[model samples]
Target: MSEALLEGGTRCLRNVLGRFATGVVAVAAADPADGTRAGLVANSFCSVSLEPALVSFCVAHTSGSWPLMRGAGLLAISILGAQQRAAADRLAASGTDKFHGLPWISSPGGAPVLEGSLAWLECTVEAEHPAGDHTIVVARVRALDAIADGEPLLFYRGTFGGFSR
Candidate 1:
């Protein structure tokens, strides 16, 4: 096939997948050396297993935050609630102070544990694989917290919204 056809095919696949609704979450880790937390908002979070409590998320190859988080032994996956739009944007932005005004605590592994999220999974990255434009990170959940309340922030058709019953 021609290069144009391959490119078009890739975009077509993404467009089709975009029809599926997904919840947004911020994945973060604190640097052991500097104690700085690096994070990014992603809708690619998903549960991979139950027996061993495995979860996975995708990060773009160019994502700077992912690298820092990968180096850490543990990470916090905060499932964003509808009211945490600012937290999402803050984590997604460039430069420092990603956790500026966000309320969070330290997890068992010293990762930043964000409050007000629907849930949080403290995990250690177990495996990684290159998938198209992103890297799939599979992690084993060492600990988890479920905050009972609030509507989840949803991502669909390139926009952020909430879900109904």
Candidate 2:
């Protein structure tokens, strides 16, 4: 494709991808020393392995929490349920007490596992690659749990919804 076409193609791709629904997840981490921690809602997560246990998520290069989470040594991937959109929004906010009024349980690795999620997966960053305006983070799952029975929160066309069947 020509350069002009490539730019237009990217825009088209973005619009096309928006039509596909995705599950929401929160990638959280804690600093064991000072107990400082943070998390953010992400619709860009997926399982990558099972034998060695691994998963991956993408974060915008400009995210402030990415630096903190990278330094924490471990991250908690909290798969949000359809009812946890508020939790997602809270985490997605910047420069705020993201954990305020949030209910969570502590993992063995000291990460916060938010309650009422479809599941929680604890991981340690194994690899990070710069991908355009985002960073692709590959983590090795350290600990996890399918803690609840519920439908996932879905993101599509800039809105939240859930499966009907």
Q: What is the TM-score of each candidate against the true structure?
A: 0.89, 0.92
Ten residues in sequence with the least summed lDDT for candidate 2: 1-10
Off by over 4 Å in 2: 1-11
- Find the 10 residues in a row with the least total lDDT in model 1: 1-10
List, residue by residue over 19-68, the lDDT tens digit for candidate 1: 89999998999999999888999998999999989999999998988889
Q: Per-residue lDDT of 1-165 in model 2, one digit per residue for the tens?
A: 557557778776777788988999999988878988788889899889888887888999889998998999988889999999889889999989999899987877889888888898889999998999999999998888898888889999888998888
Candidate 1 deviation (Cα RMSD): 2.4
| CA deviation > 4 Å runs, candidate 1 | 1-11
Backbone clash pairs in model 1 (N, Cα, C under 3 Å; residues 3+ apart or in different chains), count: 0
* Alpha-carbon RMSD to native, per candidate: 2.4, 1.9
